[model samples]
Target: MGKRHSELLILKEIAELLNTGTNMDEMLSGVLKKLLQVTELDTGWIFLMDGDGSFQLAARENLPPALCYQNLEPMCKGECWCTDRYNNGRLEKATNIIECKRIEEAIEYNWGETNGLTHHATVPLRAGEEKFGILNVGSPKKTFFHEDELALLESIAFQIGTALKRIKLIQKEKELALTAERNRLARDLHDSVNQILFSLSLTARGGREMTENEEVKETFAFLQDLAQEALNEMRALIWQLRPQGLENGVVSALCSYGQMLGLNLQTEVKGLLTLPGRVEETVWRIGQEALANCKKHSQQSDAMIQFMIESNFLNMLIKDSGCGFIYDQNQELPSLGLKSMKERTESINGDFTLISHPGLGTSIKVRIPI
Candidate 1:
């Protein structure tokens, strides 16, 4: 094929390999196979630097999949011959494996060898100017990769590095979302079950004391009422924990949160409130957790919550006149409720801050993309 035509064919193959809709390992294997075909290398290997900066053999030509999964720490950082080439930023090439000091050392260590490789070139995989790993190509003959061939190999490395960065970013996003979900569930469990347990303990103690005096009898009855309120709160917590958010819509969920608060909660959703799935879930969880915190921690008998949707964004404000705790007090105990709310806010790429003072009032403001 002509040079331009060959380049275009390689690009086409890269695109198709990326769109294979397979798992990451399978995808990497397929991409490496395609690279070998396009470059006609005797043997090729892909090394990846994991999140912790440790190198691992991600893919290899003719290597068993199980062996390819082995980790290779202290890669070029060690006292190997390849280490010298990598540290000096020089691509090593040799006609004889024995003449290549690095290959000989690596072979002696049983790490890798040039038994089937004569001419070799190592391409560094870089993402945005940061080198993440090396793409080493070997040939059975000498000087297999010329300047043009090396350029093509470097381009492949760039493509692989870009894809790896994208995949890592996507996985990180999913992890953040999962972490937020776990925090929300944990807070719900604490607020509901723990509160009920406290209520039960109070009820039992009050009942025991009521047997001695009629005045204590009235207190026991009050405890019964409080227990019932705890039950209602538990139900609300369960509803919020449901994976599905506002099946009817954001408006419906906002209204539900309002009704659960037992106050005048008005939701004026202007523009479209249809946020991204993760964002929607995050906002709903934040709202639910905030309202529950208001009821549990606020001394206010009446609170107000408003949800407003505008161009490309959603805004929420919840205010209550209650015994507010100091938000910035380092000596104060950290509440799981506050931590969970903050995490949820971060997960949605939103901002959440509580304005409050002891015996004054509390106001929570949240702004997120719609």
Candidate 2:
């Protein structure tokens, strides 16, 4: 095939690969491999900017020994030649050739096969004004890329950026739908379940007062207490389903929940309390589960929740002085509630730990990167 025809064919193949599925990782991997094959590049890597304004290596192809075998981290941070230029508003074009500090460092250390490679070309993956990431490719013998090659790479990068934007839009739509459903559920519970529970509490109290027999009065009183507790639990559940207080902050939201549960909650917040919405939601759900466990099993009237934000991580601790259960590995398994809490924490790439023993209260701790 002619040179132009070959490039067009490669671009078509990449488009087909990207449209294969909505799975971003799989699509990106396929794109990287195809880009390497079409361009005849020895190695390639894609760095995608994350929500925290950090760049994570999204995909790679034929990584050099220096990065594959050595202790080079997968993600890039701080200032690098290309990234610095991009940040300084110098990289205006879609494609630009820049020196590779990583390659220079590898050659200086005599680590890997650094043959004739000195520079790599970077293509900004962007959809209109929104920039997604940087696409980098290098070869052992090629020190610079030609205009035609850079143009082709830029086309591929544009395809990747468009795909990323579509994925993000779909994700946002899903989140909106989920939030709406949650609000509906919360409203149903409040209008129906909550009102019913409140009415039952009032009826039980009135019955206790009208009863003539001592035993009947005592029974009605017990029912009244049970009804009140159920009402408290229902309120707490409704709040969790739709946390309006989360608009202010997580700490304030949890404090309101504690009051609803009639549990003396002592909270200590250190460092910045601001967090991403998803992180805040996850923390709130885990806190709800921990506090519920305390009320149901701890038998304690009070609980303590501590929030600490360090330089790199946000930490949380929930403790109760109530009765605790034995945490036996072989004899017993985690309850469904505990399993759910752990799963929620893991979903956000957070660490969860639960400590409990007979006669000692339970303590739940979680740490998440901010």
Candidate 3:
């Protein structure tokens, strides 16, 4: 096939591959594999960056021994020419990246063999004007990329970036739908069960006053107290389902929730509450679970929550001075809901750490890249 016709064919096939998956990692890996296969290239990888310029090694295919040394340590850390140019707004098109810095350092330091690969063609991944990351492809002993080759790489990178944008929009739509459903359920519970509890409390109070017998009067008073307690618990649960004042921000919402649980929260926040929607929601839900567990296990009315953001990451800490139970590695902490908290944190690729002792207080810490 003519070179022009072959490049067009590759683009067509890759466009189809991008649509085959909604997951960003799986989609990028598949597309990179296909790109290298069709172009007869030796190596390729993808880097995905968030708004704050922090990047992750999203996908890779056919790395040299030097680059893959020590479980991909070279690619996972430290900035190189391509990443620096992209972050500084210097890289704008498919161009030959000067000598591969990472592999060059590897060779100089004798990390491992690079298989004679010293350079790559790099292109920025963009959806419209919003640039998110870069795609890099290389071949052994091929230091120069022709105009046609660079053009093809640019075309495929556009396809991949557009696919990423589509998947993220779908995720946001799903989240908004869930929020609407939760609001509906909250409304239903308040109108039905809340009203019923209110009526029960009033009826018990009337019964207590009407009863002439002392024993019957005492029984009526006890029933009224029980009904009032149930009502309070239900209100707290409702707030959990649809947290109050979350729009004011996460820390504010947690404080309001602590009030509902009758726990005094001493919270301190550092940095602005600038967080993505999904990230903010995840943090809020985990905080809610941690606080509920604290109230149930701590037997103390005071708990502390700390929020801090640094280096494009969010760190959340919830702690309580309570009688912490013995931690057994063989089993999960069901009472404190440790498993639930851990799963939620990991779902967003965040780190979860728990520290507790019999006499010492319990602390749950979660860190997530913003």
Candidate 4:
């Protein structure tokens, strides 16, 4: 095949891979592998800028032994030459080939094999003016990329960028749909269940006042209390279906929820609490579940919540002084509420831990990296 025809064939294959209906991570990894195959490159990687303005190494293929042996922490920290330039806005074109400082340093210190790579070329993975990331490819002997190869790389990067944008749009649409459904449910509960609970409370109070028998009066008073508690629970459910105080922050929302549950909630916040919307939402949901668990399982009427924010992470603790259950590592968790809490925490790449004993109180701790 002619050189041009060969490049076209490779591009066509990559285009097919991108359209394979896989998730974004799998698709990008497949694209990187395909790129390395077509170009006979030793290694390739992609760095994607996340919504929080942090660049992360999203995918990689064919790492050299030396690079693989080294700790990944440095590479992921955006310390490499290509990523540094990209962050500094110096890498603005498909043809920008830069020497690999890490490779040079490795050679200088006789640390590890460079896999014959002295330099690598970076192409801006962008759609028009909006740049998403950098696509890097390298070979042992090639110090610079040819114009045709640069063009091909640019084309592949553009395709990846377009795919990423499409995925984001689809995710956003799903989130909006979910929010709409939640709002509908909230409204329905308010109009139906809430009204019924309020009417029941009123009727119970009237019945108690009209009854003169001491035993009957006591029964009516108990009924009235049950109705009132149910009303509070229904209100809390409505608030959760559509968070009202979330605009103020997760702290405020949780406090409002605790009030409805009639639980004595003590909250402590340390450091700046500003977070991304998704992060805040995740925290709020987990908080709701934890509090719900406390109300249902804990025999105590008080709980404590703590929020601590650091430079790179945010931590949360929910504790309840209630009758805790025995925990078995080999057995499935007994509470679906705790299981749901774990799932939600993991979805955001956060850490979750549950501590409980037969007599000791249960505590939930979460740490989410921002």
Candidate 5:
């Protein structure tokens, strides 16, 4: 096939995969596999960079033994020539093949075999100044690339960058929609059910004042207390859904929430409150659930939430002195709201720990890497 026709065919083969809304990792893997297959490249990998410049080895295909040594340690971490250029704002286009640092290190250490691979072409994955990462393609004993090959790689990288931006936009829209729905529900509950409970409490109070029988007065007083408790619980639920207090900070919000739940709260924070928005949201969510669980199951009036930042991780500890129950490893027990908190922590690529035994207070620890 002519050079132009071959390039067109390669893009055509990979375009659908790029446009897929499936899991990003699955899409990246499929695209990498197709790129290597269509271009006859020996090996390839794509790095998905975060806003903070950290990256994940998103996908790879046919990696040589040397780089794959120690469970692909070389490529997974550390700085290299191509990445440095990209980070330094020099890698704006597809460029000639560069020396492979990871492979060089692997060979220098006699880590494993390189299988004749040396260098690969590098393309910056960017969407109009927002950087994603880089696309690297190489073949064994293929030390040089033609201009046409670099151009084709650049085109594919553009497609990938645009698709990434589009996916992020879709996610943001969904989040906004969810937040709006939650607020609407909170408003509905406050306007309807909350009003009813308040009126009921007032009516019970009036009945207690108007009755002469001692038993009837006591019964009306009991009803009033029940209504007041329900009202407080409803207000707490509304606050959780809308999260109005989060504007000050998650710690401030948690303190207010714990008070509303009728728990005596003591909080200790040991670091600056400089967490990413998503991380803060996760902390707030899990904090709310943990305090709620304490109020319902612990039967204890005191709860403590400790926040610390160490080694680039936000460590959270929620503990209580109330009676704790034995936990079973077999079932997640979603009813206790532990499953949702676990899922939320993992969603941010964080770690979750739960510790409890009969008569011993429970503690939940979450470590989120920022």
Candidate 6:
């Protein structure tokens, strides 16, 4: 194909990828695929510079699933061919090893063994003066990428980079709102219900001691016990709300939740995972829903909820040998509580699945991207 025609085709593919509206990971994968098509490069990789300016390999094609690109961290933090070109106000291609030293190294280390990236091009990905990352493409044939090829790649990188930044910004905003809502809930419990319950406990204790008649004394004792239970509940609520211990990670959050369920649930949360705001909110709601369901139906004595984080996703499993109900027939018009939970999850674009066979049991699993 002619150089200009190849460039146009690449641009079209990039536009399609950006408009895909899939999750961030999927979008990055699509971008890499399109870039490969454009340059016919034998090996390529995309490195995303995190807030700390350290490069984490965002996407790679020919690597094993378990072989994490994480260890393949970027050598240079903020400096690369793309950044240098943008900084120097030149989008020219680094066609040779001297011009594209980093690009050559990344290829040799990341995919050079398999794909043989002897030559490559580097493009700076920028969005409104913000340096997001760099796009590097390499080929087995030496001097495969020319100056015009680099220019074309740069334009494509610009398109993808801007979209990535925009999506990232939106995700951040969603997270901030979720944090604010959590803080608000915590404050409400601490100031209102917690204080009232505390006072009630004291009054009930005093009332019990003052009672005289046997019947009255028995009644007073019951009242005091109820009051104490209420106090304990309030305390647990406070813990869940404040969540200092759970603040370390999602594992703690799930463990605390299981303990509060008052059911001996072997809960496990794993993975170096962080969730976006909306996704977290959905998870919180799902947790609340499963607990509520258990309280109402899981008379089976115990329940188990497990959390596992893998790749860019979170896997949540809530299993209870509760009295299973028929969910296939539109079941019980889910109560407002269940409806609310479903809505919250759907709002953030997540999956909510409830599996139960009449005599089998109930298992609720939710998969969301982190």
TM-score of each: 0.48, 0.86, 0.93, 0.85, 0.90, 0.52
Per residue, candidate 4 scores C-alpha lDDT tens digits across 1-370 of 6876886787788998776534888888988988887887878888897545578778888766555545654346536767666777877787646687766666665666667877788888887777888898998888889898898788889989888877877888888899899999999999998999899889888998998998988888898899988998788778888987888999999998887777899999999999887889899999999998898889998999999988678999999989998987677767788889889999999998998987788999999988
Q: What is the C-alpha lDDT of each candidate?
A: 0.65, 0.82, 0.88, 0.83, 0.87, 0.66
Error of 5 at 262 (Å): 2.5
Which is better, 2 or 3, measured by lDDT?
Answer: 3
Candidate 5 accuracy as lDDT: 0.87
Question: What is the number of residue pairs that collide in model 6?
Answer: 1
TM-score winner: 3
lDDT winner among the candidates? 3
Clashing pairs in 5: none
lDDT by residue (tens digit), candidate 1, 1-370? 5966885887788867665434567767777887877876657676665333335566777532222223533232334344344456553321122234444445565665345544456777767765556676666655555677777777777777777767767777987787679668857786768677677857766695759777777777677677777766666655666533377776677667667667556445556556666676777777777778777778665777777776456888878888987767344326787778878887766887778888988888888754
Residues 59-175, candidate 5: write the lDDT tens digits. Answer: 898998899988989988898888888877788899975679888999999988999888999888888878898899999889888998888788889988888888878878988
CA lDDT for candidate 4: 0.83
Instruction: Report the error of model 6 at residue 369, Å.
Output: 4.0
* C-alpha RMSD between model 3 and the true structure: 2.2
Instruction: Please estimate how well model 1 matches the true structure, expressed as its whole-model Cα lDDT.
Output: 0.65
Better of 1 and 6 by lDDT: 6
lDDT of 3 at 155: 83
In model 3, the clashing pairs are none
TM-score of 4: 0.85
Higher-scoring candidate on TM-score, 1 or 4: 4
Tens digits of lDDT, candidate 6, 4-81? 698687768789878664487788887788777766665566777644344656676543212223454343233665
lDDT of 1 at 137: 68
